[model samples]
Target: MSYDEQGYGNRDSGGRGDDAYSTLGGTRQTRTRLPEGDPGAPHGRRPARNTRSLVMAAGVVVLLVAAIAFANLGGGDNNKATDSGAPGSSRSDTTGGTAPTAPTGTDPVTGKIGSIASGFAHDEQGAQSAAANYAVALGSVGMFEKSKRDVILNAVIAPSQIEHFRSTLDEAYSAPFFKNVGLNEDGTTPSGFTFVSRTTPIGTKVTSSSAEVTTVEVWCTGLIGLAGEGSTKPVSDGWFTITMELSWIDGGWKAVTHSQKDGPAPVSGDTRASSADEIAGAVNGFGGFTYAR
Candidate 1:
């Protein structure tokens, strides 16, 4: 028979008669007890059956107390339910969404590249790519040549601010500055010396950003010197931060204005300097990259 049918049959038969003894393999069993009020009854008191019932009841009570204690001790699903209702929980009560907040503290040179880039459109990756390319162009050897400088300026600067940028830069790279950097008045390199002026952006960051504009700061360390034998100003290194006010125009992020300042630089370590020829070759051979988020 099916289990349900068997259960129904047992219920119909009660705990006695054929159902109980038949389930135990046909063994006939009987309860041995004295008839009530019989003088021949042993011990004359039924030896207190209530004691066994009392012990069983005590065990059940102890188990119930242990279960309650376990629940209060932060065990099982009950504890989880209680914790969810606790005051001042970080978990959201409504949508349970947590938006990211702005980063704090003084920005570092290397990490700033990524942060600033993230403020542009197309997410962090787009910003990083723009920052990296901009850093390369800004720190390039092209800044010395008029034609290359014009090309770089046109490519990176916003259209509205191009004229201002050109005028300011033209004045800054005047004859005296060229001569000081070991170049001719026309910004040509002298014989036997390689004029080195390159900026390598270690990182990028966006302190603040929006759809129309992004305030990006590129932290860069660069090499700016004249590399050659008998050169008065040999190669030197510097750390600086470049803050670019960028605007989204013509499907790209372009700098509307830019300014730079000296850095939180550390002390230089004592190390053997490379030869002029080595530095020149390295600068010429190495190629820059387009960075991303």
Candidate 2:
């Protein structure tokens, strides 16, 4: 399911689970959790497109340009540094770099906890890698299941923040949220239906970094929903950026806190939306990447 179905909550609880995950706007911003429904529509149908949406789309284009410039300013150097001495470099100088639109042959961490990537290098690129992979894990189908969620949290969260993350997420993925997403209360998809929730990082930018801590922004696009005939929550696309504060702990980069915000999204093209079976088949056929630099 998409983060929207999860909804935002108190800080101690899981942050909001919407298109934009919980956001921290330089201060505490409290948001009430709302189910994924449009109240004015008949039977919670999505509202009709409005003029404001067009204006917003225009703004997103402008923002996308600025973001590209910013990414280019620092992305190249960082990528080269990442490309160079990843294995032995204790610190990488990311002062001037061009943000790569594709992978730069930077090797991902060699460690793994089940399918999760671990054992990241102690540098900026490592932090970015950790953030990207963690975003995938956080936005995956497993987060809906309690047992799977616990395993994921343990693998990605900093040791000190484990309990807080666990409790917060436990409360965040409530039964109501599950029902809203077309999943059973136990987080299982009904018979013959495929649930798809996947996050693919478009790129990563390091906002700040030190030997012990790094803050990275991962631009991501995702698909989430139930894929089957006659499904209310049909699979759809969303774009958001996840802000991760990662700390070097226990020989790996682990998340201390995370925040998300709506795009930087590009305008949608006129491409036809695929059928449910096509979408489901594609999701299953394409295995995800072990994201690196």
Candidate 3:
């Protein structure tokens, strides 16, 4: 995959055209309640990808980027979306897919390695679930930090590849990159504003599998940018599909490599962008979920 990890909305910006993403941009997710309110209902998972760190650096940036503008944004299959091929069309809602539900039953993770979810079930379904959740974790803002990033890497990455992945990511999270997202060179969120980035998996497909290795594609939508008054990078949504190559290791599946491509992005929505205050509030108040497939 030739890393095309950038762009959001169906509008032209920085020469990426309407359908393409600019350089790398991403954020964590904002979960809105579907009208039905069923826990089993699939909510949108943010667009996710694993970068050169045996994972993805761009996808990691995306986790802290988006904020939901509507309260009951529906998550549905992209194919089912009747997009008018216009910005702010109904497609954003439909791209999420019918299976893109909120978490249900037990939190899929049995525990956490620092903040990253861990202790996955050891089966095909379990592997898919772990990959789905890991996509969100790998795509999180926390991965920018050292200690937290280390724990997350250990939890989801194959041990043999960890050293290489970590080095790759460290180089990727450059000072210039941090500056673009309005963060200090150290990767800390600035005063008074919230940075958003999230990955919501619209659907998952296991392309091939064996007892030792598996290939999965997680089609996801993501939110990124900043929230709060005077924040220059206001929140916006984008979509992408991530393909992960996993190895069943220890008692779970771990990612050995991954890559990101732009979206099966449906049309952007017409919902008014939330005020920085409101967007910041939702980010601070709402806790992210442990995504399940």
Best by lDDT: 2
Candidate scoring better on lDDT of 1 and 3: 3
lDDT tens readout by residue for model 1, 1-293: 00000000122213222211100000111111222444457634333255434533432332232112111111011111123234433222423442332343424233223212323343333444465557656566676576776776677666765665555455545676566556788888898888766566666655555445555556666665678777665666645555555566766776654444345355443345687788878867875444433
Candidate 3 lDDT by residue in tens digits, 1-293 = 10112211111111122223222224232222113234455753433223222213343344332211100111122112122343433212333434444454645555766665667665445666777777777667666677876777777767766776566555556676677666777888898878776767777766555556665667777666778898766766656666666676777777765545556666443355577899889988998777754
TM-score of 1: 0.57
Name the Cα RMSD for model 2.
11.6
Better of 1 and 2 by TM-score: 2
Candidate 3 similarity to native, TM-score: 0.65
| Model 2 ranges with Cα > 4 A deviation | 1-98, 101-107
TM-score of each: 0.57, 0.70, 0.65
Is candidate 2 or 3 superior in TM-score?
A: 2
Q: Pick the candidate with the highest TM-score.
A: 2
- Which candidate do you rate higher for lDDT, 1 or 2? 2
Local distance difference test, per candidate? 0.46, 0.58, 0.54
